[model samples]
Each structure stands twice: as structure tokens, then as C-alpha cells.
Target: MTNQIPAENTLSIEEVQAAFAKSYGGLVGQLTLQNLSLEKQVQSLQSRLSDVEEIAFGLKRDNANLIKSQVTLEAEIAALIKAGPTADQIAAQGKAVIDYEDTETIASFAAANYGKEKAAPVEAA
Candidate 1:
């Protein structure tokens, strides 16, 4: 007689495998949902990174423009210094440009700025 296991004491291997498959299916579904959530988070982070990069690029451009403006202003100031009397000097001396050919205007300016005793005598041409 061959040794035989009682059918009630042992479960069929197929039934155990089916139970495992059902549990694993649920776990797989949960994992799929978690994966989708993670993907969305990654997309959000990437979008934010792109926005930050754009802002950095704009700031760099603005900084470059400001530097260029500063250099241009410095060069202009240097040229003005080389040219001659600055606004400060002109203001301090109270000097004004007058048309030399306008004798009447020159006479008026001379009379206003200088007393007749110190003013140059006007010559009649």
C-alpha cells in the first residue's frame, strides 16, 4: 500500500497560488497609484525649476544692462572732464556764454555783472 495524504489535511497548490495572485494584484494596483503620484510631483518640480531658470536668466540680463549703462555713463563723464569747464566750475564762476557780435547784449551783461568803473570801456565802431 502506498502512503497517501488525507485530502482534508493538505490544500491544493493551485489554490494557494490563486490566493497569492489576488493579494499581489491588489499590491500592484497600489504601487501603480503611488508611481503616478510620484510622476506628478516630479513634473511639478521640473516646471518650478524651469521657472527659476528663466528668472535667473532675466536677472543676469538686467545686471549686464546695468553694467553697460554704468560704463557708458563713466565714459561720458570722462569725456566731459576732458572737454573743459564742468557745470560746477561754470556755476561757481557765474560765467555765461554771450554772442560777441551782439554789442548791445554784451553791454547789458557787462553792466549787470560789473560796475562801470571796473568794466571795459566800449568802443564805438
Candidate 2:
């Protein structure tokens, strides 16, 4: 008796290989798409990182300049304290010399223009 295999029950090797290849190709396509998406995300993050680094560098530079200015100002203040006040500065601190004529003119202008009755205050609600 000859042994016979049923066609419906038997799968061909070529058919199995083709099925496996098709499934593998589909998986590879999905993985490729995922990889592309991840790459884009990485690129975006890198771009953001670059921008933050630039901003941080600028802030550092600005802070350094401010520190230098502060040091210079402190040194100038120290020198000024060491040297004491100038003659003109000491003279300016002395009592003012009033000009009586100017004072009288200013007082007359005030009396003429601002001696009127004051405005009544408004009542708050």
C-alpha cells in the first residue's frame, strides 16, 4: 500500500516560509516607523537642550559682567572712603546762603498765585 498525505492537512515548506517572511516584513515595517518617531523625538529634545544651553551661557556671561561691575563699584566706593570727601563736597554740605531778593520774589509769586482758597476734600464712599 502507498502512503499518501492529505493536501488539506499538509502545509508546504514554501508556503510556511512565505508566511513567516510576510510577518517578519510587517514587523520590520512597524519597527522602522517606531524608530523614525523616536529619532524625531530625540532630535527635538536635542534642539531644546541646545537652546537651553545657549540661554544658560548668556545668563552666565551677564552674571559675570554684573559681578565685575559690582567689584569695580565697590573698589571705587572704597577709594572714595579712603580719600574722604572733596573740598567742593564739604563746601556743599555747609549751610545754604539764601538770596533775600530771590526769596522775596518767590514769596510774592506764591502769594499772588497760590493764596486762593483751598479746594474742599471729596467724601469717600
Candidate 3:
């Protein structure tokens, strides 16, 4: 059967309106995808910042502890000298204790800062 339809009857106004609505929906979907991707990136960055803050706080705590220990050590050394352990022996033993404490403090400071997860600067170098 061969039949021809007039252009006016080819598409109704209702059909045109429906087509436009579908196109608008597709556009909204694309925008929503972009919005979600941005949100994910923001969350990732926030997590990284939080990790850094935690490491900084831990380092501060380590420094506080080290200072307290150093003060106690000083007081103990003064008392030992007052007790008369002689000069040379007192000096040698005291120096050994101080050296050990210093090394431990340095190691703790480094660990607290980066948690063995990253490279750090050498203080003496």
C-alpha cells in the first residue's frame, strides 16, 4: 500500500513536547555526573588534609615528652653530682645517658612526624 501523509499530520504538538522533555532529562543527567565527580575529588582532598593534621599533632606530642624527659634528666644529673660520684665517672655515665636519650628523642620526633611513611630531612646534615 502506498500512502502519503501531510506534513502537518506527521508530528503532533504533544509529540514535539515529549521529545523536548527527553532531551532536557539527558542534559540534567550529564550535569549530575559532573557534580558527582567533583564531590568525590573534594572528599579525597579532605581525607589527605586530615591525615596531615594527625601527623602534625603526633609530632607536637613527641616534642613535649622529649622536653619533659630532658628536664628530669638534668635534675637527676645535678643530684648525682651533689652526691659526690667524683668528676670523671659522673661525667662519663651522665654523658652516656644523655646521648641515649637524645637519640631516642630524635627517632621519636621523626616517627611522629611522618610515621615512617615518607622521607624526612636530616637535622644534622
Candidate 4:
């Protein structure tokens, strides 16, 4: 014969302790799962931060290079202003060679008359 315990029956102290222990175990398991999830999120954030740092470093380097190039260009411009018109500038102004010829020609001049107008040699002097 199965004897049914009444719903109002009181639990002993050991039974109550066992019930609390079981509930506590479940709570601990849930807390562990939450901790693991939070740790994963932290790791993801750290990885994204590293990537952003790398991009910032690259941008910094590029900015430095651009500044250096700009400085160099300014210096070159200053030097050009100090020096007389460069060949390109003179060409742009349409100045021509001494024996101006409207037509273009190519020729190699010989040095056969070199030093002819210099002072005569000791024997001739």
C-alpha cells in the first residue's frame, strides 16, 4: 500500500539543508556561464581596440610624411625664388639662344678654333 504524505507535512532540518544546497548549486552554474560570456566580450573589445590603434599609428605616420614633403616643397620654392629664372622658367618666358633661329636644327660644333685668340706663345711674343 502506498502511503501518501500530506501536503502540510513539515520537512526535517537535513531535508531543508539539502534543498538549499541544490538551489545554491544551480545558482553557481548560472553565474559561471555569465562570467564566461563577459570574458568573451572583453576579449572581442580588446581585439577591436588593437586594430584601431594600428590604424591610428599608420595615419600618424602618413601625416608626418605629408608634412615633411610639404616642408621640402616650400624650401625648394624658396631656393627657386632666390636663384635667377630656371631653364624651364626662361623657356616659358620665350627667350631664345644668342643667334636666334626661328627654326629648330641640330649640329655638333667642332673645337678646332679653341684658344686661338689667347696670348701668343713665348716664341711668338
> Which residue runs of candidate 2 sit more than 4 Å off their true CA positions?
1-9, 85-125
Q: Global CA lDDT of candidate 2, please?
A: 0.69
Please report, in order, the local distance difference test score of every candidate based on alpha carbons: 0.75, 0.69, 0.74, 0.66
Better of 1 and 3 by lDDT: 1
Q: Could you give the candidate ranking by lDDT, starting with the highest?
A: 1, 3, 2, 4
Q: Residue-wise lDDT of candidate 2 within 60-94, one digit each (tens)?
A: 99999999999999999998887676544434332
Worst 10 residues of 1 by lDDT: 90-99
lDDT tens readout by residue for model 1, 45-102 = 9999999999999999999999999999999989988766645644433433233555
Q: Which of the two, 2 or 3, has more lDDT? A: 3
What lDDT score is found at residue 56 in candidate 1?
A: 100
Candidate 3 residue pairs that clash: none
Which regions of candidate 1 fall more than 4 Å away from where they truly are?
1-9, 81-125
If scored against the real structure, what TM-score would every candidate get?
Answer: 0.57, 0.58, 0.42, 0.56
List CA RMSD, all candidates.
8.8, 16.7, 22.2, 11.0
Clashing pairs for model 1 are none
The 10-residue segment of model 4 with minimum total lDDT is 104-113
Query: Model 3 over residues 1-125: C-alpha lDDT tens digits?
Result: 77989787788889988999899889999999999999999999999999999999999999999999999999998988876655554465456446765544454455544565431442342
